[model samples]
Target: MSTTTTAPATGTAGLPLADRTSGLVGSVIDSSTSLLAKQTHDIVRFAMGSPAADAIPTAALAEVARTALGVDRADAFDYAATEGDLPLREALVDMLADTTDATALDRVTITSGGMQGLDLACKLFVDPGDVVAVESPTYTNGSATALSYQADLLEIPVDEHGMDVEDLRGQAERTGKTPTVIYTVPTFQNPSGASLSLDRRHRLLALAREWGAVVIDDDPYGMLRFAGDPVPSLHELAAGDPLVFSVRTFSKIIAPGLRVGWVDTDPSLQPLLISAKQAMDTCTNLPAQRLVEGFLRGGYLAEHLARTRTAYRERKEAMQEALTEHFGGMARWTDPDGGFFLWITFDSPENNTEIDAAIDTEALFEVALAHGVAYIPGNAFSPSRRFPDALRVCFATTPPARIHEGVARLRRAVDELAGAAV
Candidate 1:
């Protein structure tokens, strides 16, 4: 009566695989969500770039869903247009009309999410061995998408003002090659929480024009500005330039679970985008698109953004205050005007010179997890395994008090690691 269990196949020993598989680097930031989910203990999560639970307009969404996906609305559950549901596309155009990312319906193609938009852009423009420039601490998913297309990534360093355009030029010069695709988060960049300066934006466009490179402007947080003056999006700056491919998502503003986003490309590329999307998913989830359309048409986004912006600003301040209180002498962090993350780098304090040189944030991750704190190690954001001394902390999901607790736990983890090294 005893049953023998067979071990599942391991590794890709005999399976036919393409060379592109080698470039399929996975995302540690996303894997952390799965890793943390299995833990039974209470962990103060500062890892995922997600909106707070309260930030999601659940009740409003539920009300919208009642109509958007009601039994009477049988078409709501049907497949959407490859370009996008017409109503949703119209709504999106209207929603963005007054914003820095304003766009036309002719250029919009609904995507599964921001990640899909990134993938689509790579699929369209990136050829095998093509040079792709990305920020040093870029969005893991974005860089991974480019890598999946067999792109040769050149990591450009980012400062408080965002991707260093001068360094980008210097690196291209050093390598004697220009990028085929320049991928940038630009506004409130992921991991670094830095926006590309106005001066740099112009320079980047000029460089792209000179190099004939396609600029993948992946901007998911441009509308979340809370602390600083608004900056024009690359989409806005390009002003109908076909070289700029703008990817946007409702995940940050609305809810990630909806998985609804869109790409604003040239009208000439719209047909190709539809073909690409049809080969992939046929179309975006119809119910989700309907829900987003309802949310947008009901005039709920403005109020929701205003409320969340205020809350995020307060949370960012709280996180900074906590960092100052605990690691004031031992660390430095970025001050983002409006975004979900703060980039923290361990520095050489006068009293603790060993910290900057010895402690590796990658190694400290396990210790931090045990201490009931979770943050993405800076190395996870880089393709070249750079930033061993730094990490990215997300303050958007956690409340002020929880943020304080999480920062304290992070400090304890650092102390534990520092003491172990000593």
Candidate 2:
């Protein structure tokens, strides 16, 4: 079941209720645009033509609801600390310690999600129009949020290992005023599906120090690693010396609806973030925090993560095989160690469409939708680059069977373009 509301005539314009909003929302049709509504059509999910619905762990969710309800529901209903309720904060501290420095406690703020956690970086560090170094094709949400704060988003190229350190150092030299922060997704990046090598991680932190800039490490997909040993978080590697905030999220692992995430960084920004947080939803839902805390305590999280890992790994395998079987010789994609995405890069010769056409790139988005499938184009994820033939396919939502069907449809679409060129 999906919710529905009348689409506003001028959504972004904010016209008077009585007046017609003739303003164009062309942004949604712009390849550079990032709209959660377009990216996630919760209002009309049935039109998506994908799986029935993501099966949430209802039993565990029920447990969480009941636990929070039972534990002084009146207090849980009250406003919580801007830093998040002390108990949830403590729980985060305990959970995050396994990944980073435990005693480096001064640098933790409970954010709504990795998205808000990243937004806090701009609020505290970046001034309007200030440049911020970002990996080319980093998460759009990060870039979009940065744009909202009026920062100049800089792009650094990424290889299989992740953000290029030499290019970053060169960019720093060119700017002379190192961006406020350098951001990267390190492991299991969004579209490229690349992970920063351990050496690159060390190199990045050192470059940030050299340029006198902070490192805004936004790593929501770190935990979903289906295979491979966990790398030390950027904060853990920096030893809390440089101004860095390691952002983590429980979305992919548990549920995005919960929106439980945290950022660990220097205490200098805490007061500012507390203020920004107050204006934005007043410390997140307190009762929600209590419920998530209960969920963590029940020991179901471990099993839940295990199940997610297994399921996603299988989905990844299915997508990988489909690409190989259906588009094998014609397409190339990076194999991720632990994440929900696989990026398909068609051979250049096979790509004839002049993506630079004045026409909005997002127009092609409707092509896939018409094909009874929906996916984010690569350009939206990487506005700073000419990555036209690339597309990101999420394996988290669709089941294995549909993964093949969707890829088959995509292959046909690509072939149609190739045939036109001939």
Point to the candidate with the largest TM-score.
Answer: 1
Residues 115-228, candidate 1: write the lDDT tens digits: 999999999999999999999999999988998998999999999888998999999999987899999999999989999999999999999998999999999998989988
Query: TM-score of each candidate?
Result: 0.96, 0.84
lDDT of 1: 0.90
Stretches > 4 Å off in candidate 1? 1-13, 349-357
Cand. 2 TM to true fold: 0.84
Superposed by TM-score, candidate 1 places the C-alpha of residue 37 at a distance from the truth, in angstroms, of 0.3
Candidate 1, backbone clash total: 0
Global lDDT of model 2: 0.68
Worst 10 residues of 1 by lDDT: 1-10
| lDDT (Cα, tens digit) per residue for candidate 2, span 1-422 | 01111235643476464322221112222232333245553221112111124536768878778858675678888888888877877776666565544534556777787777877777777777778888887676676666666677778988888998898878777877567778788878876768888899999888778778888887777777787777777767888674677787777666777777888877877787889888886787776788777777777777877787787788889889888887765557888887767777666553524221222223434545555455666665664545665666777777788878887776555555444445
lDDT of 2 at 30: 25
Model 1: what TM-score? 0.96
lDDT of 2 at 70: 75
